[model samples]
Target: LLSIVDKLSGDSGIGRTLRLAYDFRNAAAYLKYLWFSGEGEFKSFLPWGTLEPDALRGEIENILNEQSTDIEPALAGAVEQARHLKDAYKTPLAVDIALDRAYYRYAARNLPEGEYFSRWMAVMSDWANLKSFVRVINFGLNRKLFWETFAEGGDIPAGKFKEAIDLDTDSIPAVFIHTEYGSRLSDVIKTALGGEMSGLDLFFRAKLMELYRYTRYCIFGPELLWAYAMTKQEEINTLRVILRAKGAKLPFEMIREVISVVLE
Candidate 1:
């Protein structure tokens, strides 16, 4: 990335974009734990951290005054959504959902437009909503409950999601048929509805791999860095999956089934 930026003319600040993003992105971790209870419940998607609730809130306040942007909407939405989540303090899901929505809607800044990474973030936001939506349907959750978590910047619209989620379970897949993800995700929805939940996880990884595989063919550019880093990350993720499965004594076929998606 520095190499690419160096080759550009003066006043090109793309080199600094990623660093600025990480500064606020890391701040999100502190915001998500604002309701933490030190009692050690499995409370978040990210790994547990040492910060207490007070400290987390203080950190969020600083970010809100600093970035003076997303940190507000992200937690502000959660403040409203919290009333609906009766056990909001016990689980971080509501806040996490709020953050997801605010993140795509406002958090993205300074991305290199037209780059794969920018598109990747938008698509990941969509997939995250899709993954969460699937659970809402399968678990009989209220369709309205998902609105706070709905993300922007994707091909799909929030109202489109609303209409789809309002449908009966069997008819839901039909709503996505004309969307970009239709052909690839139609069967994924069916498989998830069939209760093979692990398939959804594999599908997410597979779609990410498929969408970015072109980076691997770029022989002379910053994309080569993306391809190399993706390869390494996939290797580590694959090994981690295998180790966890083997540690649990999962059958050989099961281990193979999960790891196969890493490369595909």
Candidate 2:
């Protein structure tokens, strides 16, 4: 994988980022396996001579960081620019609009959640300055929906769970069926999906975010989120290909088939 990344880094034109990203993924998987097994002299294989695993995270971070000066600079610059662009919005509507723009306009959907959400929050901070309503609505919505996740055993803190869901039972008929969050993940998921019809919007995005978060932390114990990220990575490359084709005055119809709607 390291060799592939080196080769991809040296290559020019034609989906270079995609090739690099693909190789990076191979490294990520290998590092994940090593960390999970908690065995072997993994340090011997790492190119970073003196680095050691401070946590399970050391391997992948080292690869991306130590790899040529190019990777770190590009990643840092992209992060900085994303944060800068997000600061332009100054209202709830503006914040949402900025996110929407970043998603489709700048191919922001291709970024990892850490980078993507950081950008979102930076934009949101400006929007909050213009209108307190942004925080009120956003926090109220998040806190209310967070309890629903708590009540459904969504890996949220147990101590905060009960208080968060302390709302009128009479107003919420669905909560009555599942009095406490189930211990079993299967039960939690079933109740979350089959019960409750009031908070669909929050539920879906929350679920996606949770899946994305865990997949990053836990690797491919669940397949969907990893697939989603990779799918978006491919989309980023596809968009670049389209831009390049247009610049070179080539037909784009054939390239369109290469694009995928989802990572899988």
Candidate 3:
């Protein structure tokens, strides 16, 4: 995927955004590796953007060897923020939430505003925030943490999430009533609140697939490429689910239930 995105040339906005997204993922992974393993090696990491793989490896090694705080500033900053939150709250989830917020913020800053790709990313961010909200609420975690974890750049304002956190489960859908995702995802939100956690990803994937359908009419553009990439990812996810089910010797019906209907 990184190679394919890198090969695209001449005003490929989506490609550039994808490369940055990949970089964010790699950077986060590198930080997590250092935090857990107490060592840094980029042998298994994907390389893209302005950072060369060899240079990144060397920098990571230097940081590990000298116990230096010097690393890629963006990733280093995110890790530091997460570490601060973890120290204050003593929850590992703070690390994930901080990294995710940074990832979405990076994407939003890099992508052009008001474009389809940017809107799609906003929807993704909204879905992530919604998922985090559901988890925090359902698990009886601290509601105050939501404010810190909320990723900016979503179509749904952070204020809406703050308000929704106080509402009854039945009234939660009202928070999104005016947004583009409201109609499509309202039922999913209700279902998720009812304890169907898997529905969250299922609903988001379905909406994303539906969004990609419009790109089918375009003869040429990044939309088609984006759709293809999304479809391939869906396919990969489906295969992984099926493979896991088979390995576990799960019933066919059980496997079928976990399979996403959007791809079918």
Candidate 4:
């Protein structure tokens, strides 16, 4: 993935955004290293983006040495959010949410206006927020935490999300009635409310496949590459699930339920 991203023209937005995505992942891992008291093998980290290994080491050392203010804005923002959560809630889950919010924020900020990728990012954010809502309700977690974990720049307003929490399963669809995700997710929301966690993934993957199909009509541009990348990722995920199910000697029917369909 790193090599592919590197080979793309410097002007390519998709390539630039992909590198940022990996950098955000690496940044999260670096924060995890600090949270664990630097116990892990630092050499095992997959370094990418503008941060070289030596530079990343210096940044990490600076963070540990109380010079966090010098760190880059994107990473520093994520670390600061995690730090606040640690001081207050002291939960590892909060750190994950912080990094996720940072990543989406970075993507939304960097993506060009009037592009399909920007629209896709909005859809992605909505799906993420929806998943967070479902998890919070299903686990009986505090509703206030939803605002902290929510990623901005989605088509659905944050206020709508806040309002949706108070809604019953049947009423949740009304919150997104005019949006693209509404029809696709309505049945999935009902199933998820009934405690079937996998239903959400099923709905998300199906909707994503539908979106990817639309990208096929683009004759030239980043959308083609982006669609291909997303398809490959889904294929890889499906394979992993299949292999794991086979290793466990699960029946085909049971295995089929957990795997997503590949759109050709």
Which candidate number has the best TM-score?
Answer: 4
Candidate 4 least-lDDT 10 residues: 1-10
lDDT of 3 by residue, 94-203 (tens): 66777778767766665544467776787788888988898777777788777777776677888788778988889997677777665757777888888897878877
Q: Could you arrange the candidates by lDDT from highest to lowest?
A: 4, 3, 1, 2
lDDT for predicted candidate 2 compared with the true structure: 0.35
How many collisions per candidate? 0, 2, 0, 0
Give me the displacement of residue 260 in model 2, in angstroms: 13
State every prediction's TM-score relative to the real structure.
0.66, 0.21, 0.74, 0.78
Per-residue accuracy of model 4 over 158-183 as CA lDDT, tens digit each: 77776788877678766666666666
lDDT of 3 at 242: 87
lDDT by residue for model 2 over 11-38, one digit each (tens)? 2221333343323333333433443445
Per-model root-mean-square deviation over C-alphas: 6.0, 18.6, 4.3, 3.6
Error of 4 at 132 (Å): 2.0
Which residue runs does candidate 2 get wrong by more than 4 Å? 1-14, 39-264
For candidate 4, what is the TM-score? 0.78
lDDT of 1: 0.58
**Candidate 3 stretches greater than 4 Å from native:** 9-73, 112-114, 168-179, 261-264
Clashing pairs in 3: none
